[model samples]
Target: MIWTLFLALFFLETESSLTQSAAIVPQDPTLTIGSSIRVTCSVKPELNLKAENLYWTLNGRRVPSKFYTVLNSTALNLTLNNLNGSKQQSGDNLLCHSTDGRILAGTCLYVGLPPGKPVDIICWSRNTKDLTCKWTPGSEGETFLRTKYTLKYKLRWYGRDKECQEDHTADPYSCYIPKDLALFTPYEIWVEVSNRLGTASSDIITLDILDVVTTDPPSDVHLSRVGELEDQLIVRWSSPPALKDFLFQAKYQIRYRVEDSTEWKVVDDVGNQTSCRLAGLKPGTVYFVQVRCNPVGIYGSKKAGIWSDWSNPTAASTPRSVSERIAGVCDPKSGEQNSTFRRELKQFFGWVKKHAYGCSGLSIKLYDQWRVWLQKSHKTRNQVLQGDKS
Candidate 1:
């Protein structure tokens, strides 16, 4: 029994010794950028090692001998100056090695900036069901360390402060609260960031869920030509389906662009109308249109609701110019040349007067070309008539 007890004690001592490090001073230190530090490695007396035979490595790379200071026969010192931020959030690997390249002692060097005050904490709800918030990092925004960001919120009057679970892998500065949000009650929200160096909290914001609610994009956007009008197309869309049951008045915006172009022209005067006439479009050209909605006084809240995302693009084309249609109608192959020309000129003037409310420069240019052609056609007709009489 005594021998067994001795064996157990021997194993325990060995395990304890293995758990202890080789006595590196300033173990696992945290530091700011541009700060210097002095680290020391001490050898156990039983190891029979000399400090002079010791060397150091930082992040697996050998440190130059100029930074080494041999304090005694069993200790060695390394001084680093003007340290930069750590290469990783876990910290920089610093190891002391023997001359023959055996690891004697090791520690991590955490060199980075502290967390700054989180700024621009903005929160919005989806149909007043849940809340989501995002914030901008203070200053340069890169902490270079493993910083923790916590989003805390509560009812403005009285409630337990709760943390919003942050999905750092998805978005480091954003958090989503899925359900159980109050509608009319105001919420106090803020973000707090922390690291080993320091901590800072953002300015708290108070808002009701109804005040910041946003709905899905407007749906079923349809576009069509405005009845023989060359420069106009009619766009129609249904209000956001999610908010149809809610008590709110929606203001819509329409933006369109020519199919071949990337620049968009926005129409903001489309009050609450689901159908709007887009004018001043290029004739006989395809256009893409999109619409968005802003709910005003949602649930009788005084503040305007957030704007929904732009709807999917819908495409339509305007009709060709009146002159083009007239030319098509008065085909020379179907009728006598003199009679066809006369019919085209008569239709052109009447159609332009009826259709061209806001005539574009292209329409005026077409009219000028048609006038010159008409004068030449009349001269030719007179010549033909004279020849027949002769």
Candidate 2:
């Protein structure tokens, strides 16, 4: 009786293996959405099942016999109509079964839409060091899958196409190109996207490396009063980190606004220096001042690089309005030793000019020009006073 039971179990197991051996057609196919596709199930000739004995199931639901046809006793075929992205992306599973409802064989169907072309690709470089580009996903942004994006770039005249390394920026659609970039040679850039369905590429954009140069903002900004002059504020800042090697000349701009006002008054003649004296500010009023830099003549090119971001605002108030304190110190009240008084006043102004650059006095250059003009004015003033007495 035990031998009989063992043989019976063996026979059942063999029968189950045979039932599951039917070959499902197309074996995990990938196809486009809205397109029609065929699937088939077949078995060995000796084990061929009659059409009435065979059936199919999709995602655990019975497939209607009306959608299938029997080609022979050994083969049955099913046709899917208007395949959708959901079916493709999820890899819908199909199974062949006996009429009694046991699974014979199975296959997963892949149906999804290909990624659409990327759009609006644009790029910029930071202080001529690295290039960064970003784009918008194309084709309704629905690939029904986790699509991958890549940035590809190359020089117009040299080098092979290269892929940018993602430094893990917050923007997934952006890519950074680092190191050994050409400043004069134009670069072509684009984005490529791909997934199981298909791949698409964005339009190519070309740009000069210098044209997109932006750098870290000027740092260590400071503001202070200019001597006793209540209408002047001196602004100073250091160069950006990327430009600190003294490899290029940088032009600077200074702008200021009153604490209670939004209007900014920009100084256009700060030139390439790192310091500027701002005059004509309202005495005793708080002013907000900022500085920006643009590198010029780097790499021996005449083009001026793009401006860096504005430095953080530095606040300072012009000194309260005061009468001329130096007038008493440098002036001879009764014109005694008039020649000696003139020399003393000149000496006093010279000392003030030396410290003026760091303070609110006119810039050193302006101070020199000022002293020359003052000498002419002082000589004329004394002559006129002496003539009036006579």
Candidate 3:
């Protein structure tokens, strides 16, 4: 009976010892470039065990303690900094053995390079005004190693290896291009990724900057006359290009001189649009007219193109009757009223006759006469209205 009891006790002790032995299980069975990894060894429960003599081997070569950490008599964590964990590292065995010289546990880590070749890179503008670049991210399977990526951009304007910018991000995909660069320039960009194992660069991508050109001008421009006394001509024009996004507010100027005068007068200080009238012309005298347009760009900067060639000058004369007074109502007030009424009647008759056949083929002399009289009548009425109000 005693022998039987002793034998049973001995067997139980041996079984317990075997069960308490340590075993190494790598957290990640597969390793990749640039990834940080941990390997652990679990030891069976044993009283008074100390973390001493834990050993790790990477690919048949002993990994120095500087590269790995041994914890609590069991766990071994290896951080292969900057070292790409690849096929060679994967085939190597990581061992955790006891100080007692018993092999507790072992596991082979398989490291691999990330699959897939670098893909094409593409670039675009952010606001149709600035450029941007982007690319696809690298991918690994479920057991993939963690990775960091960088994007490098170079401008062709700067020459080879000269203008390079680096961008670092956790994701492998996408980057923004710099904004507000000069229009009509070219740029080149590339991307790269690095893991513990190694680094790979993507193909270079090139892009060009282009201005959003305005193919058409604002549209048909027309002129109309306005104003009261002083024989002022009020020229008014309509807005061009109805499309809200495309439409640009513009500044206007009138270039005019007395008939037979060679020098041009510019009235450009006025900002944006298509109209201005000439004032203080002699009654019955003809004046020539021309118009120029100035468009405002971003930042309110003026962009002036060639001035439109002189429009066929529409001639206008101040009303002569307004200038010459008659007897009917001789009081200064009565004289002014009678003169204004006659001048207006004459101007109206002239305009009717001139435009009766429409604007086409109207003689320069007739048109000029009609315009002068029209301006004179309009100015006189405004002066009278102003005096009455005052």
- Computed on alpha carbons, the lDDT of every model, listed in order, comes to 0.83, 0.76, 0.53
lDDT of 3: 0.53
lDDT of residue 309 for candidate 3: 33
Positional deviation of residue 63's Cα in model 2 after best superposition, in angstroms: 5.0
Model 1 gets an lDDT of 0.83
User: Per-candidate RMSD vs. true structure?
Assistant: 10.1, 14.1, 21.4
lDDT of 1 at 114: 85
Which portions of model 3 show Cα errors greater than 4 Å? 1-112, 138-143, 157-172, 178-180, 211-390
How high a TM-score does candidate 3 get?
Answer: 0.29
Q: Is candidate 2 or candidate 3 better by TM-score?
A: 2
How many clashes does the backbone of model 1 have?
0
Writing each residue's lDDT as its tens digit, candidate 3 over 1-390 gives 999999888866554443357655553366555656666666655544455456656655667778766565545555665445444423556666555645666776656565333466655442234444556654543224444556666557774542224342543466544554555455666777765446677777765443221222334434333322334555554433432243255555567676778877777775665556555554444566655443335223233322323344555544333444322323357887799768766866666665665655555445446655665665788789889999
- What digit string (tens of lDDT, one per residue) describes model 1 on residues 280-336? 687788999999988878898788678888999999998775555545643345457
Question: Which window of 10 residues has the lowest lDDT sum in candidate 2?
Answer: 322-331
| Per-residue accuracy of model 2 over 172-254 as CA lDDT, tens digit each | 78888778788788888888889877788898888888766777888899998766456778898888877677435777888
